[model samples]
Target: MAPRAGGLYVGKMVRFTSVGLRYAPPAGSSDPGMGQDVLSDLSFELPAGSFHWLLGPSGAGKSSLLKLMQLAQRPSRGEMEVLGVITSRARRGELPALRRRIGVVFQDFRLLPHLSAFDNIALPLRIAGRAELALRADVTEMLRWVGLEPKAESLPPELSGGEQQRIAIARAVVMRPALLLADEPTGNLDAVQSRRVLSLLQEMHRMGTTVVVATHSESLVNAYPGPALRLADGRLER
Candidate 1:
């Protein structure tokens, strides 16, 4: 599968084959063996332009899996193909380009307090060297899409948790990356706001972006009725 213009692939956008991850023991421990595998033998394929929910309890390696998908961390062992690029085989210089094609919504709304809502959304485009004139329109439209148009000039500190989360989302998708990975995106919002955020992600999926949301909220997962990948003890359950 080759990555297309939008970061999507002709077939699977993400493919994990016997993937495994194990972190080293803190600094120095008498442990000779490798730390326990955080995730083991995890195999799955996320179809391009498809939507999925990653379900699991806390410490179930849900975050770890999402990290691998976002190219934040490579698997300790096994193969991963994201956006049709073999992660392990990709050169260091090629990573930034590969990453630009994916969008990620972190569990903790990682917003830049110094920047306004508009600037936050415009960051990606700015990094890509978009013109200032075009950035205003594109960022404003993204803020509007996330229902934060009025907060464009407001700093992250001035917004509520929900607002910050939405801003993070807008920023993530501002460039229309081909793949979107959200980690517990609704953790800070009430039921209504949660649904609204979910709907936004769904809309992105409809627009040809492959979306994967990691969450332990059963209610949230149940509402969508989409395919879900459940994890427990570092293994995936279909």
Candidate 2:
């Protein structure tokens, strides 16, 4: 597709037009790019049902960019449309549903320490108020998909880092979100475990979910080459 204004299409899985996000909220100033911004004058597009790598060094606004894509933070200036919703102008009450359609996997594997693996993967379904019996079977299948079926009863603290990360992936995809974002998902795993996690993410992309993975691992980038959006010193480099 040919580019539109700001080099972004009108409707995509993700779109940013002259977007800038600051260290603090826009605070009714209307022009957020004027502040000391973490991401300044960024503009790009992630097409529906496509996978892309977010490549950048540490402190290069990678995390900050993902935060915007996932609607965790609003674009302080310019426009952002994620999952078909213009999040910058979306009402506060309307964002929850949009967020539910997006999944996020973090570097720390933010599983609840108190919850068992089964419950942890089931958390999203439970939050959406699914029937208890149905959600159990779904969660169980997810555990098997991630090769963590045996750890269903294990707590996060009891599981190895690899196991915990797998559980996190399962939880992130349990709802079959339209878009998935991962922040250094393989950062804590060994080479073998990293391969496993990356495969799961690739599988998700193959199933038609738009995916973006942020990573600093050169080895990972080499192993799984794809179209990438690179950041440098708070600006898009590609």
Candidate 3:
């Protein structure tokens, strides 16, 4: 059954049931138990179009969990379903189509150094085979939306950290993905910049994108009233 939100049935965008993950030990590790589970028995349901904050300190498996959700890694045990598809058991051949439905913002702002902001933002649409003529207007609009219309021709290295992050965000959502996952997106920005970025994400949520952000910023999380999923020692706190 779909979960109810605001008196309406909202389907689950992501679901984890007794999920666990552990890295394999190094090739020459003397101790067989060197590798330990970074995430364990995590069970949760994120309804469609919901906004969530994934809060945890360093090494609390926040990124690991996001990786699983992004289908970059499979759970060591249990099941994970994302976008209504069983991710844990999905085949490699079927993952690309599924992954294209998700947008991810990394902590490092992984933008191409040589590409202009406008081009970077248009990369996803181009990969989806959008016509160049149509892409120009859409990309221009996204740049304006992110308040970077003037910097549309600037390369990533030419922009400030905040600007680069914003461009990265604009690129991620250019395709209007079903799910948006950001990892420590505001970690490098000041309080004000962080708020601005958060606001952009909020706008995306308002447009019906399910958003999940992994961050250690308590003040930022507190400033926004949303359900928080906290992790400690690899386990989710209720």
Q: Between the candidate structures 1 and 3, which one is better when assessed by lDDT?
A: 3
lDDT of 2 by residue, 167-219 (tens): 99999999988889999999999999999999999999998788999998888
How well does candidate 2 score on lDDT at residue 219? 85
What's the TM-score of every candidate structure?
0.94, 0.91, 0.92
- The per-prediction CA RMSD against the true structure, in angstroms, equals 1.9, 5.5, 3.2
Give me the candidate number with maximum lDDT. 3
Better of 2 and 3 by lDDT: 3
How high is the CA lDDT of each candidate model? 0.89, 0.89, 0.90
Instruction: Measure candidate 1: CA RMSD.
Output: 1.9
lDDT of 3 by residue, 1-238 (tens): 3454443326999999999999888898888656889899999999898999999999999999999998988899999999878888888888888787788988889999989999999999999899999999999999999999999899999999899999999999988788899999999988788888999999999988899999998988879979989999899998
| Residue-level error in angstroms, candidate 3, position 90 | 0.8
Tens digits of lDDT, candidate 1, 1-238: 4736633456789999999998878786878655889999998999888999999999899999999999998888999999888996688788888788789998688998899998889998998889999889889889889988988999999998888988999999998888999999999898887888888899999998999999999988778889999999899986
Query: Candidate 3: where are CA atoms >4 Å away?
Result: 1-10, 29-34
Instruction: Please tell me which predicted candidate would have the highest TM-score against the true structure.
Output: 1
Q: Model 2, 100: alpha-carbon shift in Å? A: 0.7
> After aligning candidate 2 to the native by TM-score, how far in Å is the CA of 203 from where it should be?
0.5
